[model samples]
Target: MDLKAGWDGTWQEFLQVDKTVFINELISFHSSLDWTLELEPAQRFAWETEYDLMKSMLGHVVRESNTNPETCWVAFEQELIGEGGKRAADVNLVLPTGDLFVVEFKHKTEASEHEILRANSDLQTMLRYHSESIGLVGHGYLVLTKPGAKEFKHSGVVCEIADKGQAPLLTNQLITSLRQTGSYDVLRWSKGEFYRQPSILHGTAQVFFDTKIPTLKTSASENIEEARDALLKLYQHAKAKLKRYVVVVHGRPGAGKTLLGISTVASVARNDSVKQSEPIFLSGNAPLVQVLQHTLDFYGKRKGKDVLGRAIDGRVMIEDLHIFKKHIKSSFGSRKETFVVFDEAQRAWDKASPRDSQSPSELMLFCNWLSSQSFGVLVLLVGDGQAIHRNEMQLEQMLADLDNSVRAQNGNIVAIMPSLHAKNMRLIKPIKRDVFNLKTPIRQSYTEHLDKWIEAVLSNNSALARDVALSIESDYPLRVTQSKSLAERYSVELQNTLHEGNRKPDAFRSGWLMSSHGGQFIEEVQKDKFKPGKRIGPWYVEPPSSDNSCCRFDAACTEFSCQGLELSLALFNWGSDLLFRDGQLVLAEDNRHRRQYDHYTEGSYRVLLSRGRSGLVIKCDDSETFEYLKNCGMRVV
Candidate 1:
């Protein structure tokens, strides 16, 4: 009743044996699974089909033995808990040497990328567990039972497509491969590989593996997926009828508009209708674009070059908005690149002035080109409200451009937002039906209550903020320190907190959140540390090279630099420029912050406070201001 293939290293010595004897010995090592109408009792139609096929492959001897008392046990209905969540293995086989083999069954003609990813995830968990806990090896086998299942390879592993009665042999080979090599072909996240040091805000290099936890899809992402589906449906219709459409998708800060837009482009690459079309994903945020491009390059070095290269191929080109604008002017006709998705679309600039002649902003020009030249093109404009710059066009201006002469004739425009009222779009006719909204927030780890609390606190709604803050319990711990010395201590503590909850030291990301008004303090802090060190540029791009805490202390980024990014922890320095009096936010007389604090300071603080996913430590340098904040019910440490 030993169902295992008995791969007990005996075959290694059989190389000297006669051909017939070797063949017989090899066949002897081959094991069989006990088959009975009641034994496995196929759970589904696919399982029944696989079970019958397995029975036929086992021959009469193994089939007859199914009725006898069982001696071997195969793992079925197995589930394991991972750091992310619960995962299950459809079929598991234990080798004679105690090595494990797993099979993820797909009944369809082609196993999906998502299915492969799930199988790989299950494999990694089993491999890590068996190696660490049980001193055993685990190999993954992705089985596509149905005919014509597309075979593919990822990382170093492969998608196995098996015809009728061929699964067991493939499973044997998979186990043998694992036994031969300690590791399987899959994504093995290593420490120190993708290390990002804490910003000048926190002065430490923490190691963090890019392990995006697989959770239930958030409402925002779900809505985005639905919108993406709708987009594709429209695309299909447009393709058949030879029409064009403009779909606007808007969200608030931390609403995942960037990731959603990128994902939409990737989705288009996978679709059959527009798989051939090259997708152009453009973002005006240079740091965002650089981070994404770096992501691909970093993986190219870690993952085999050819693997990712093939996976990406001409499918996607993530471009800088300025570069795209420059290139689109010279290019003409409906090329292979048909789909265009723009992130932070609200930042698209409008034409300056007729007298100044700034080459007629990229917005109007791109819209004109899309309208007049491109055929059956679907444009997805993903907008957010992080417009910290002055020259940036608002959503209203972008819509006005969309309603221009060329676009109106070529395509119908739609506006979407994250709220009931599509802000600044009231001027457009038939606005009510065309505008849509996505209500959920998905980009941050913070919960709804935390989001509301942060918003209320930033908006100076003292009562509601206090109420919301008191009721909410979140991992994003907020602490306010009155003393400068305590603030310094808390900054380090926040960095340490970034390493908590199963996160590695190298992965911890922390930064200093300072207002733009504190330029003199930053300059003094910088000049004292490195004598001749230059002023701190964007923290995301030009972080201080020195690991010294003194140097890092000087490198603080304001809302303009740190927006659209998240940190694990942050040290928010509350300067004298903005203070709290009796519960209301009060701008001081010598206010250096000229960009409308009343309208934008709340948003700036919102951006800064929400940047830290784990925690925020606030430092109120002014004693009176600290006392005022304390009276406002903020947790003062």
Candidate 2:
């Protein structure tokens, strides 16, 4: 077999290093390459025109291989840029047999664990996509781009041996080419018992491919950019001054506070001052943690200049805030990481919380404790909202005057946050409110008037709420209905519209949002059973294609479960948590354990109303609240 397809400019632009060696390495893994960079060194020779007709007669071209030659190709879009590959991945190679191979070129002479996992994650996603799309075998191939005449050595599994007891993956042409460079043993992989237990990244092909790492955004909104700049300065100050620095990035429900946190983590990782250590991201919000972790695997694709500034890898240090405490409790103070990003730091548990978990405030004190031992800089991502749970809300009430909460003892900053003296509004000073705060509303991002209308409605300002409601009605559909079936149908329609076709499942998430704390009243009134507690995480992240997905209409999330999470189309069921009494929203007068404070009740609705990225649909079967909302100009269906 021979590589007859034009090697072309695509390969040259993608693989910036020595193309020949890469080609030689790649070709050796498979029997044939579908692409040809240039005529091989031996094949480039031609007889001299000295009437070398004699040599032509004597030197007959022999058949190259016993196997029949076939062609391989790739699908490109626009400027023929590759379609199914990330920038860090060198190429998504289509073989002559119509199979796909995702090639990741690493500069490592001996790949580190981080490099291995990152490459595997990228390859796994692409290969899975390829196999699912075309029903053809897909695999991952790694090429170590070592310099000079040094042969790349990988002590671990190589793509050469695809699986246990399998013959080498070498094609006839590749074998020939590889032999000219080095001995067969140099490239051969032994299928030992150790190699049999394949990694998740290599379910089939013994190669890299695992996590679906998302490309980070370099361009952010002005508010988020300002917060990030302020955070960077704080990070630098913390690093140099050797003290704990807390910068609270606050904003309206959806104004990109989380994005600001993500940006800060990326900025810190790239900061030259802390080259010895990378920042870790911690969050009390499990769903947010899952979503972020899903996007940023342990170690994301590390690209040289081939990547845009947008692709920031090494978001690997992400963990649920509680889990971090579990793993490193003993070494908390001496941990090498100098900077940390805590998502939804306001919702962090206090001393009143379960003894098993460490509160956000406790973690802050640890940040203080670490200042002398290592270094400490904690960037808190707080949002504008009331506490979601009883423990946190109660703590908020107890420490109402959080300004006086801090008490330094033994020259150590004792932030009595919950378990410690928590700061009021979760704000640890040394902050420029304008620079650190994110004011503009980005939640219900499609409609600027959504938050205002919700705020007005909760505050019983009917005229202002009505005016705001009118403006956003067209873009942010606010629908009310008594029928659960009707609400589900409309949610399905909205979700379908978001996807358009079989583009991808859960293209934009749509699901039911209701009060999480309810009993028999919730069951009979709301009519739909919600998969509460730990199950809420998957409901947000799982695609509609899965039965477990929130889009399935079989599941729902409460205010507690979805505080920082959102769906594109949120079908909210106004539960008995809040009731209309004396022209105001009040906590429900329920006999069960659903008793909540006024702020908590209003805050719950505030969270529910702003949960939808595109629009909100209220399933309020109750006539009293329904009439109140309908009179406030909520679109009735």
Best by lDDT: 1
Instruction: List where candidate 1 sits over 4 angstroms from the true fold.
Output: 1-215, 236-241, 270-276, 305-316, 329-336, 352-362, 376-385, 405-436, 443-447, 482-506, 521-554, 581-583, 596-598
Report the Cα lDDT for candidate 1. Answer: 0.50
Residue-level lDDT of model 2, residues 253-349, one tens digit each, is 6566665666566556555534454677787766566655543332233212211234433235566776665545555544566677777666655
What would the TM-scores of all predictions be? 0.56, 0.55
Which candidate achieves the best TM-score against the true structure? Answer: 1
Q: How accurate locally, in lDDT, is each candidate?
A: 0.50, 0.48
Off by over 4 Å in 2: 1-220, 233-237, 240-243, 270-275, 294-316, 325-331, 348-364, 393-433, 443-448, 498-502, 519-534, 581-584
lDDT tens digits by residue: candidate 1, 1-637: 0122222112222222344543343234321212112222223454445445433432332243331112112343344433222233555544344455666776777754445645655555455343221344556777777787787776523567776556655545543443442332111111001111122122100001221211123355466567666666766675676555555676766555565566556555555434456666777766555545544544444444432225433214666676766666666452346677777777777653334465666555665566554344545454544556656766666666654523344334333333333444444432332323555665333446667777676567767766665654222346788665665566555443221222223334455667666434453222122355432222332322435323255556676656666665567788666676665666766657545535566556666667765456688877766765554456776
Model 2 poorest 10 in a row by lDDT: 186-195
In angstroms, how far off is 455's CA in candidate 1?
4.0
Model 1 poorest ten-residue lDDT run: 187-196
